[model samples]
Each structure stands twice: as C-alpha cells, then as structure tokens.
Target chain A: MEKNKIRSDHPLDAMLRTDRIPHIWCPGCGIGTAFSACMVAMQASGINLDKTVMVSGIGCSGRGAGYTRLDSYHTTHGRAIPFASGMKLANPELNVVVFSGDGDLFAIGGNHFIHAARRNMDITVICVNNLIYGMTGGQAAATTPCLAKTTTTPLGNPDPPFSLPLLAFASGATYVARWTILHTRDLTKSIEEALNRRGFSFIEVLAPCPTGYGRKNKERSLDTLKIYQERTVIKNGAHPMDAVMDFGNSITLGKFVDHDRPTFSDNYDRTCRPHFA
Target chain B: MKPAVLTGEHFMTGDVACAEGALAAGCLFFGGYPITPATEIAEHMASRLPDVCGTFVQMEDEIAAMASILGASCAGVKSMTATSGPGFSLIMENLGLGICTETPCVVVNVQRAGPSTGLPTLGAQGDMMQARWGSHGHYEIIALAPASPQELFYTTITAFNLSETYRIPVLVMTDEVTGHLSERVVIPEAGAIKLRHRPAPKGRKDRFKAFQPGPNGVAPMAIAGDGYGIHVTGLTHDERGYPGMNVETQIEMMHRLTQKIRNNLDDIIRTESYRLEDAEIVIVSYGISARSSLAAVDEARAQGIKAGLFRLITVWPFPEQQIQKLAEKVRGFVTVEINLGQIHLEVQRCAGSRVPAVLVGHPGGAVITPEQIVDTLKTAF
Candidate 1:
C-alpha cells in the first residue's frame, strides 16, 4: 500500500516529495499532473519554501494540501479562500496558494471566490477543473461541458458551462489564465506568474478524471490527455471584444488575462494606516 | 510594573473593555459583524486591532466571520469575533467546527433577548443554555460571565487563554446590561498576565498526531503553516487526523474529545462562593442578574438571614460538584436569573431531592431585582 507513490523519471518525479508519496488521489487520476505543475511553479518562483502555504477545500483536489511538502491547510468545503485570506492577512510575508476544484470552488464556494477576487487578495488560486466531480464518483459539476454525461445527469448536461477564465476576469482577478494538465509547462509557467502577481491571480488547470469522467465517456487517461491536447488552442492574451472567437465548443486554455491592481491586503493596510503602524 | 489606571478616562463601556482586552491579549485578527450590544466590541476592535499590526474585517455575514477566525487561528494568530443572539445563532455550525478541529479561538456573545430577534439592545440571559447546546452534537465548552466592565476586561483574557490551553472555543457570555454599562476597569500590568499556549508536539515530525491526547487529555496542536503535517476535519476523525467512521474509531475519538474537558474539570471550572462558609441559604446566580443577587445576599446577611451568594464564572459543565457540596451544607437554594427558570432546572438537578430550589425568574429585557431575589431567599429560608 503505497498510496501516493511517484516513480523516478516520471514527469512528476522531480516535482514531488517522493518520500511523501502515496497521494490521496485515486489511481489513474489526472490530479497528479496538476500537483506536479504546482510543485514546479513553486520551485520556479524562487520563493522561500519556508514562507509558502497551500490551502485546500474538502475534495479530491483538497488533498493537495496534505500531500504537499509545504505548510498546508485542509479546510472545510468552499472555505479555503477565507482561511487563506485570513492567513495572508495574519502574516503578509507568506506566499499563500489555494488548491480547490470546480464544484468545491464554484457552486458552494462561488460567493467566496467572487468576494476574494473583489477584495483583490494577493494570493494565487489554482483551480483543478476536471470538468466533473471525481471524489464522489463523477457527479454533475459546474464545469461539466454541456452535453456530457455524468452520474446525476446521465442523459446529458442540460445547463451551460462557464468560461472560468472570463469569470475570473469579471470578478476582478488581476491575473487569469487556463491550462490543461497535458500542457504541464504552460500550466507551471502560468502558476509561477500568478504567484508573482501583486493582486488576485487565478489559474484554472483543466485535468482529467480518468476514473469517473473518463470511464463514463469511454475515454482512458491517454485518450483524455489527447482530447485536452487537441481541444485546447492557446491565446497569448485573449480579448474580451473577441470573446466568441476565443471560446467555442472546445476547451480553450491559455494566458487569457493579465493586469495590475492594488492588492486587497496592501489597500486594506493603506486604508487603515494609522491602525497598522 | 504599574497596572494601567482607568482614572479620568472618559466613560468607558464594558464592550469597549472587552475590545481593549482583546487587543492587549495579542489578538491580531478580528472578523465580525455589527450587532448590538456586541457592536461596540467590533467597533473598538476595528479601531484597535489595526493599530497593532492586526486586521479587522466586517465579513459579509456572521458565518464568514466565524469561519474567518478559524482560518486566522490556523495561521498561528490569536483571533476572535463578537456577536449578539442572532449573529451568535449564525455562528453555531462553525463554532462546533472550531471545537472539533481543535482550533483555538474566542467568541464573545453580548447576549440580547432572543428566540429570533426577541429584544435587540435589551438584556436577557435566555442564551445561557443556548451557549452550551446551540451547536449540534456533544462536546464541552468554557463560557465565562462578567458582571461589570472590570470583569469583562479580565474575563476576555481568561477566555483566550482557556481556548488556547484546552484547544477549545471559549465563550465570553455577557448580557445587554453588563455589555452596555460604562465603568472603570483597572487594566492589569502586562507582565502580570499568564497566557496559555497549546501543547506543542515534542518528538520527531513523523510522531505527531493532531488528535493524540496528552496526559491532560488535550493534544498538542500545531498551526497550519507550522509544517507539522496536521490535518483537521469537522467529520469524526482518528488521532492521525484521518476521517474515522467505524464503531471503535467513533467511540474512542468522541470519548477522548469529551474527557478532554471533563477529566480536567477542576482546573477548567471556576466559581466564587461569597460567604457560603456558614450560610443557611445559598443564592445561585450568574451573568448580570448575579450582581443583583450579590446585593440581596449582602442585605440578607446584614439583616441576619444567613444568606450567601454563589456566582458561577464558568457556566458550562455547570459547576455541578460545587453545587452538590453547597447543597449539603445549605438549607435550601434560591436561583435568580434574567431568564425564566432556565438554570433553575440545573440547580434542581444538582441539589437533588435533598435541597429545595426556588427560582426568581425574569422573562423580559428587565433584570431581576434584589428585592425579587430577596423574596425568593425568604421562601428558601
């Protein structure tokens, strides 16, 4: 029972704390790729590991905090942001990051996500968007593509899906980007850039749940990775004016938005200057 | 070192004392909403916490406020939130979360009348039972009552330390009267204060279990960023921080959780027995009404009725053993509170069939009077 083992020479071998392996994720899952990208991003940022914190909500993706070597929190569902927000405010020196999923981050935690962005908190958020809920056996998720089959929606997804990058931009994130696990390099780079940004920065990493979502669609891990590779078209900076051009029936992944804004903590401290000497 | 004198400090209120106490207690994060008479606490905390490199946030609602403090606590900072009946009601779930997760934090309830918005800005001790049983499930809580601004200042410090020591949520339960009253509190010298720290793990990192009980029943708790690989969940969990649902895991975890408080009842329980040494009748009271009972007890003693006062500082765990001991010596019990016969039931239980219990109840915002309590004392005699 090696639950979180990562073999050497694997793409994630360098990125992981091999001794801490036997991750909380199930076998043949795509979350390992997302976690690998996260590790690479932290290393690339040159930030001190001592000052880094990873916070996660309750889900399969939420376990990212537990398995990661960095200081981490496994908080309640949809509450990772407020917890991370408090941590960031308590110690402004820490580089805080939130790892949550589409269902946990969007549906139940939708209010917090928008508010965290509105506050323009200076923390990076990497949402592992598997397009389906994998933890509870592939339930219908907020990011599930329209016309897809799931346990709850065995007939076909009737509701429309969100363009998460656009939603992040609308919610006041200073940096917003999207990438699939297959594009590890770009995903890792986007995460690094998000970490360095001054205000709220969000990277939606599209991962595959080969066990739940993939099994339902008769798609294996290789098939799911190929699907992500073929469907995604990278745009250096997608324009809001030509939003329709950037988004279609396919899953669009790229560096979608980048702008500077006063971080929530910085502005809050500035506003309460007399109180915070 | 000289204690901070409250001389000529213009009209300081009890809620303000609580805010100042929190600031002095090294509280660097306050997440709360504005609800009277608890609003002054938030206002003062907002004004003060920021001055000390701390942060104060008026969350979208009380749930966020409660959840935010839990987050702040995990980040290795002393944190707190203030609310009245309704806001306190909103925080029930998360308060339980804090308890089960062993997250040390403070919740101040400047209680107002309520089932739902009973009497805003008016006093009521109706929430005494709610403070103990508001959150679902079984667990122990430490709630302190302050009769004046002086006690409010001292009790807030005690509340934080209790929370940190036992790794449980501590409630500073005050009513509208005491919370709103303006009085002088002699702030103790900072050097004189003894703060409690959560027991930290002693051995190698791999040996640490977030829920493993020490000899005292409390486990060593490391903050999230301390890199202890600690895991906490609202779900029933084993000592290793993994979710546990089996009969054995469930039984052992919960037994330890409850014993963590019950086993250390001597240190955790606090009360003051005023002149109970040779008294024939004992008046049991707490919160604001206890002040009036004290006056009535003094008057009864002067008139030579042999009456005394027992003021419960730690309201939960109910001081049952102390009550039993007092019941043996005293002829009868007179229970006086702003609430109508709530704590009277507890008094009846602890007194058993041996001692008679008389309740002087007040069902509204108005407090119980000493004359009313005196009448009950007469009946007990």
Candidate 2:
C-alpha cells in the first residue's frame, strides 16, 4: 500500500506564498480573516495576477504584502499609498492595491491617504482597522474608538476617532465601503467591486485584535464577531456622514459612496495628450 | 518624436540643465515638490516630461516624492526627485528605505542654507555631511557635487547611471548658486551619451532571492509586473528578502549594504586636481566654493604662494586615501565651503595631527569669499 499523503491543498494555496506560511498574526486575530477575504476577492475578480501589485506600510497588516505571492513591496512606515500611486500611474494596466493597518494608514500616513483620494488616483486601498496598533503593543490609533482601553490609553481614549467612510467620501474616493471581519462574504464582495471600479476605491475593514485591542477590552474574537453580527446595520447608498461608528450606539455597514469621476491619470492624459502628439 | 538628448548648446540655469540631463539619461519618471532654488527643476520637468512620454508627479510633500520615485524605479523606470534643504530633511527617512531595499533612483538636493529653512533663496553647502549620514543608519551613500551649470547637467546624468549601476540612491548635491546660475550647456547626442541599464534577473522566479548579491554585490532587479514575485522590505532581510531579526543576518546584510560601495571606491570616487604638483598649501572644496577656490588658487599662485585646489566631484566616499597621501606632502590644508566646517571635519579626519586643517566658512547667507580663503591659507601657513 502507498503511504498516505499528509499535505492537503486549499483554495487559497495558489494565491499565497505558502513557503512563508505560519504567518506572524496572533491567534484569533482578524487580520487573517480580512486578508483571506482580500485573497478570495482577488481570485474572484479575474484581474491579471501578474499585473497586480500590493504595497504595504509598516504594521501588522504590512506583512500581508510579504505573504502574497504577487509582486509586493513592504515599504517604510506610512508610505504605502504613494508607493501604490507610483505603480498605478507608471503603468495604468497594473492593478495596484494598498493593504495596511489603521495606525499605518490613518495616523502616520493620513496626509497621503487624503491626497491620494483627492487626486482620485486609480488604486484600491483596503485599510484593516484594528482600532489599536497591534504590532507595536496596542497603542491608541487614530481610528481607536472613543473610550476604548489601549496600552497608551490605559484609562480610556478621550479623543474622537475618525469616521473612515466620511473621510473617504470627503476625500473624493469614487467608491467607499465599510465592513467588519465577521462579514467576510460582504467584505470580499466589496473588495471585488472596488478592484473592478475605476478611481480611488476604498474599503475599511474593522478587524479584531485578540492580542491587542481585544485583550485590553476584555473581549474575545468570538465576542466581537457576535457583537458585529448583532449591531451591524446594512445601509447601502447611505450618506457617509450618517455612517459614523460609536460602538455603543450602532455599526453601519455598506457602500456609502459610489460615483465616477476622472482620475489623476485620466486628467493627465486628457490635458497632455495633445502636447505629446 | 522629440529626441531624448537636445544635442546643442543652450543657455539654461543649473536646475533646468539638471532636468534636461535627467531626460537625456532616460529618466522616465520624476516625482518632486516645489522648493526654492530647486523649483525650476520641477517646473522644467513638468513641461518637458510629458513631451517625452514620461511621467511627472508633484507629490504632496518631499517624503511622498522620495517614496514615489523609489516606487517608480522599482517598476522598471529610471526615476528622480529634486528638493532643497527642508525638503531634503523630509526625504531622509525614505532615503534610508531606498538604501535598504537597494532601489535605484537619483535624488537632487539643490542646497540652500538651513538648520531649519535658514535661507531658502541663497546657496549653502550645509548638506554635505547630511547627504552621507542623514538617513539614520550605517550605510554608504554616493554623493556628487557639481561646480557649474554644465557640470550639473553632466553630473545629473552621471548620478543616474551610477545609481543604476550600483542599485543605490545617488545624490546630486548642487547649491542654490549653481542651481540658479545660467550658463551655456551643450548636451551631447543620444548615441554619444553613455547610459547604464540595470541588469535583468535571470533564474527561476520562485527561487530567486531578492537580496542575494551577484559578483558586484548588486542583486539583479525585477519590476513589479514581471513574474519574479519579489518582496522588498526595509527591515534587515536575508538573501531571500525575508525579514530576519538576528544579529547574524544584520551583520551579513550590513556588510553587503556597505561593502559594495566601500570595496569599489576606486571606480566610484572622482575628483579634480589643479596645480597640486609640489604645492605646499592645498585648498579642498566642492560645489560653488570649488570655483571660488580655483580662482583663489590662481590669485595665490600669482602672488608667489604654492597653492593648489582639490575639487571634489564625488564627495561621499570622502576620497580619504588621497587626502591621507596628500597629508604627508602638503604643509597644511585649507578647507572652503559655504557651510560652517562640515567637510572640514572629514578633511581633518583624513589629514591627521601631523598637518593643520583650517576652515574658512560661515553660517551661509552668502558665498565664501576667495580673499577669506586666501587669508586663511596664508595665516595657516
């Protein structure tokens, strides 16, 4: 009798660089769920894998770029957006994605986030909002909910967190959506749609950090997912300003902005093509 | 189609000449911010890049501009960015990223006086040491200083070529005087101008190690769309480009990062020696001050003093060996720069206690006068 094969193939095995498996994500961390959804969406979207580039800044989610088998860059802290912008503008044929954390994207890289969205650069930004700086020992991030306990905010976070949907909508993102890690199917669909959309599509995924945010709040991953399932209210086509999150009140989940406009490269070609000719 | 090289003499400022040289060197992407003395470089590139079917992006800030150029270069396009003092300070963080990832790009710092925006409109050589050590790491950098508009044009092209050849971020350290000064620059024909192309990766894509060194210690590069599946990061990474936090990995990574340039200094360092044969007093300078030093040298020679000017074209590898050899023969060294003794420290280090190294510099609102340099030389002797 032949020896039984121990290795089993999975659907995402092709999409990931399996050699880099056993990733550094903590047990019950929601980044893996969000990243898995992104991978599934990438597979479902039918974009050319060879022409896809993933850029990430320094954080836990920054490691996503390294795990993906696609051509990826783990850039410096707070620089993924501009790096992705460079790739997209240099070759419009490529599908560029910026995948990083809330602290990396909203705090240190906030200026780039707004400007890239304002320019309406053609790129998909999947920001995983874990509410705390998970990689750096649970510091209060810009997206940390008010009154949330973090390492830095030992008592409670006094500062109000940014409403990501409203920020993206105001910054001129063509498509903006919000979802929790528990809503994997919905998040995957949003990512697929954003990947197909033309200019500056943004999706903010509220992920759980069992080791960081969860530990401080004394909540497990399952408990947060349960809260997300109970509290999330789907409001498609809702106004971005009405979608602000105050976990004590309610969690709004759906596409908040969907409108088309000329991207930076589109405008560049329209104005400069005659001169080039 | 517009030719890449202009191939004729044209009156242009050093900043504009630097842009033209970038075009002639086949730089297809320029990401920059508008800063004084360097603004004309971006202004010229804005109009010129589109005509040549190149990409030009005015980034939100200097940090983004620096990051964008690195990204464009990783995408298989030769890229560059230009900025002044304050912007140069912002670019230092990502400059380290460029060095760590071994990305090939040219960064032009048209120097202005500043610890913090001191004199944006005036020239200074304050960033000489900053260009070498501003990035917060132990890494070797290649910096070239141009003395005139003509030299800026050629040196810009040389900077790009050297960057590609070494797979490192090369700095074209010019000054506000050199940048704004207008002169006749003759751009050679496209065929006559030498260009260096980065070596393409050759092997199995899955098995390729992104940080592995070749014969010259430069790992072959692959663009994003290529099937290489390369992962580039800023952490101390192994040959496979995976982050390895151990001291052994850091030692190996740092050795490769620094030894490539340090081991090949003979090919990288370039300097111009004028009237140095049997001269008792040597004047060391670069950028605009070098021109002043040369003029002072002529004056000193006319006055029956054995004075020679040693102008640094490539300022960073410091040319320590040459300075060390000259330390024995020369009676003393007089260093002239717009900044307050930045390069003087390097000269002093190279020329030990045996010889005196005096500095004639200021806080840098104006140029160092040739008379001051001559007086310093006479007093030191």
Candidate 3:
C-alpha cells in the first residue's frame, strides 16, 4: 500500500523545505501549529516573499529559520533581535522577521527586545510562548505561570510571569497582539497585520509543549487546547495592559495596541544622512 | 555617495585612523558599543559612516554589537565592530558563531589591561593568546598587530580585505598606546588603495549551494533578497547549509573551516624585518612593544652587538617558520611586550632548544622601554 500510493504536494511546499519534513517538533506540540500560522500569514500578506528573511535564536521554535525556504539565520541564543536589526538596517529593502521561543526572546534577549522597540526598528517579531523552557527539559521560564510545576520549580513556580503584550506595548512597539495556537485564524490574520505594519511589531502566540510542560503540569495537549477553547475571551482593541494570561481565570486574547511613529530608519535618514545622495 | 577615501595626509589618532581604514576598505556597516580606549573607533565610525550613506548603530552591548556585524556581513555588507578587553570577552561566543557560519567581517580590539578591567586607561598585550584561542573551540583566526597610528590605518584596511577573501572575522589587535597615539597618516587616492570583495553567488538559485566551496575553498556569499534562499546557522551544516547533527558532518565542517585558513598561510600571514643580515642576536616584538624593540636593536648594533629586529605584523598563525629559520642563525632571541610574556611564550615554544628565547616583559600598566630591553640583553648574555 505504501509503495503504490501516489505522492501529494502539501500547500506550503513552496515555503517549506519538505525534504526535511520530519521536523524535530514532537507530535501534539503546539509549536508546529504556531509555525504553520506564521507561514500562512507570510503567504496571505502581499509582501514579496523573495525579499523576506527569517531569523531565529536557540530553542525549539528557533528551528523555524532552518525549515523555511528563504534567506534565514539562526543566531546565538537571545541575539535574534539585534541580528535581524542589522540585516534590516543594512538593506532596508529586505523584510526581516525574527521567530523564536519564550525563553530566548523574553529572558536572555529581553534587553534587545525593549531597545529595538524603543527605536521602533522596522521588523516583525513572532514569539512562541510555551511558558516553560521546553528545549531544556522544561525548566521554568520568564513567562511560566505562577505555581506551575516544572523541572526548576520542583514544588511550584513562585515568581509572577511577565505580561509579554504589556511589555511590548510599554517598550514602544507600534503593533502588539496575542493569540493561542488553537486560535489559528485569528493568529494568522494578526500576524499578517503585524507583518504589513511599519514600526516594531510583536505577536505573542501561546503554544503548548505536551512533552515538556504538560507532563509535569498534569495536563495533556488536548486538555490544554480544550482549556484555550473554553477559557479564552477575545477582546479586540483593548488596552494592552489589560491583556492577561491567568490560567486560573479567563485568558484575554486580542489585538491590544496599534499606532505609528517614525521608525529608526526614517529618523536616521532625516538626522544623520545629510549626504544620503 | 561621498568618496570614502580622504586622499591626503592627516594627523590622526590610531583609533581614528582605523576608522578611516575601514572606510577605505569599503566597510558599510559598523555596530559596536562604547568602551574606553576603543570608544573612539565607534565614535569616529558613527560620525563618518553617514557621509558615505552607510549605517552606524551603537548596539545595547558588546554581544549585540557582535551579532549585528555578523548579520550585516551575511546581508552582503562589509561590517565591523570595536571593543576593549571586557567587551571582547562578551563577544567571544558570537565570534565563534561568525567562524562556524563562515561570515566575513572585522572585529577591532583596542586591547587594554584586564582579567577584569585591570586598567581601563592603560595598554597591554595580554589578549595576544586570547585573540588566538578566546572563542571557545579549536579554530584558526587571523590577527594583525600594528605598531603606530600609521600602521593601524593600513592594518585595518588589510583586515577587511583578508576577511572578505577568506570568509572569516579578522582581528585588528591594537593597543591602548597605539589607539591613543597621534601620527601622520597618508590617505592615498581612493583608486590607489586596493580592495577585496567576497565572491558573489551565481547560477540558478534553486541549484545554488551556499557552502559549496569554490577552488579557493570560499563559497560564494548570497545575501537576503538575492533569491538564493540560503540558510545560515551556527549549527554544523553541510555544503547546502542545512544542519547536519552527526560526527561526519562535524568533521567535514571543522576540517573545512580550519583548512581554509591553513592552506593560505602565505596570503594571510605578514611580518617585518629590520637589520637581520649577519646578526647573532634577534629581538622579536609586535605592536607597541615592537616600537622600543626597533630602537633597542639599533642601539645594540651601535654598541658592537650583532642584534636585529623581527617585528611581527600578523601575530596569529604564529609565524613559526620565521622563528625556526631565525633560531637556526641567531645566537639567542629577546621578546619584548606588555603583559607578562604572551607572544613571548610563542617565541619560546618555536625557538625550542635551538637557542634561548628570553622575555623582556612587564605585567601591564607600563610600556616596555628600549633601555629596559638593553639591560635585559646585557644580562641575558
């Protein structure tokens, strides 16, 4: 039966390296869904795909740069923002996108994130928030929920988590939004919107790590998605400060902030490039 | 665009000269942080890069500065960064990343005294060994040591050209004294200065292999928007630039990275010799210390001592052959430098039992004087 079966082309074959199809992403992992949503947004948006480049830091989601059929870079851990900024600044015609996980973007790469947003560097940053450091045996992460069980938090997580959207908005990101991987349609549309925007755009996609986080949390992958379906409340155009992710309560999911200001390139050209002939 | 070269003689500090050298070499992007001694390089670049329609970004820290230059280089621009010892330590991992990914760029280290900010205002050659082995793995690196502001200008240009030719980060290891010293630097006509550019990718984009080596062992580089869709990573990769996790791929990649440098020793390594014919004593040095060593060699020659100067222009790839040849003819060797014997150790190792290799060394904070070398030379004999 296997030998007789005819081959079929996947919809994303053009954007993906299908020969490397057996990706390291585990079954029931939400990272694959989040990655798929990003690809869909890339296609749906009208940007020239040839001019697009993907950059990733070290982690499970960092593999996104390696899988994409585009000019891509997998930089050192927590360095994707600066790396992406360099590429964008060097060639303003190229579209630079940074794709990585929570531990990478929020913890180690936190300083770069805030500074890039403060300068309003023209780039898109998609962060997959799995709550725990999934690649390193489910250690507690900056986004890990309070009282969540993980390897580092043997008893429970004692520290409060960072509100990623609030942080992005406060750091001067022009576009800020959040959605679960289960909210594929909303996530894809939001990513497309961010991609087309001019200033620093950040999209936080809450993903489930069944093997890494779920096993220790006493929840299965299906249960996590079911929780998202039942617990999430969509509230578009809400203040980004109000966007919350308290698993004990209803999760706030929506586009939180959208505005515009002069980007770094625009400011540089105006102030520094007097001889920009 | 503004002409990159100034095309005249100007009195400038070594740091400023290094910046002009970068401009002459066609470096379009400079991403660096502000650290003492090296901060002038960043400041000069920040002010001058705009004139050429290029970009100069002061990153959040040294790590980001390193990352930014690597990114800029991979995007088809000759890029660079400058820092001191503390910053250099922070940039080590990204330096390794540049090596692993075969990105062409330059890193200028205006080295100062350190173990931990030992003396920010003082000069030292303590990083001579660190420049060779600081980046965590066993890989070959090219480092040039310049003795004066004038030499720094030429060395910086040579650094960029070498990096482009060999797909590796070249280090301009200038000292605090050289960086701060002012001297006359003749910037020739832009056309007179030679430049080297990275190989450009050609053929069908679909069939193009990003890491597939040319006859020179350097693969053609493709930047973003080139439509070649190259994947670059710090992970071990194959000729196609895809990650290969196994040992065979690691062996192939490591061998390729090291051999790319090893095979081109002639083109990569450089040195300067002064009054060596029919001499029995050799005084070896580089950078700031080499300045006094030149004076010492001449003074010794005047004093009826048959001494010669062997100044190291390119410090790493060690110049083992030159030392071996010199050891065979010279009665003894004298290495002078700041920092307690860094490259002196290299001289000692290379000279072996053929002759005694004595170090005229200091432990940071002060310059090694020609008189001190004269004293050591008189005593060692």
Clashing residue pair totals per candidate (backbone < 3 A): 7, 0, 0
* lDDT for residue A143 in candidate 2, whole number 0-100: 92
RMSD of 1: 4.1
- Quantify all predictions' global Cα lDDT against the true fold: 0.82, 0.91, 0.92
lDDT of 3 by residue, B101-165 (tens): 98999999998998898899999888989899999878999999999998998999999999999
lDDT tens digits by residue: candidate 1, A1-277: 5967775555455434455467768776778888878988898899877678888887889878767656667777778887788888877888889998988889877888888898898889999988888888999888887878899999988988777777788899988888888898999888988888888999998777887798887878888777776766777787633333122346556787899978877777788854433
Q: What is the lDDT of candidate 2?
A: 0.91
CA displacement after TM-score superposition, residue A170 of candidate 2 (Å): 0.5
Model 2, residue pairs in steric clash: none
TM-score of each: 0.88, 0.98, 0.98
lDDT of 1 by residue, B4-56 (tens): 22223445789988887777677889998889789999998776665676789
Instruction: State the lDDT of candidate 3 residue by residue for A75-188, as single tens digits.
Output: 999999999999999999888999999999999999999999999999999999989888888999999999999999999999999999999999999999999999999999
True contacts kept of each: 0.42, 0.66, 0.83
- DockQ values of all predictions: 0.43, 0.75, 0.86
Write out the backbone clash pairs for model 3.
none
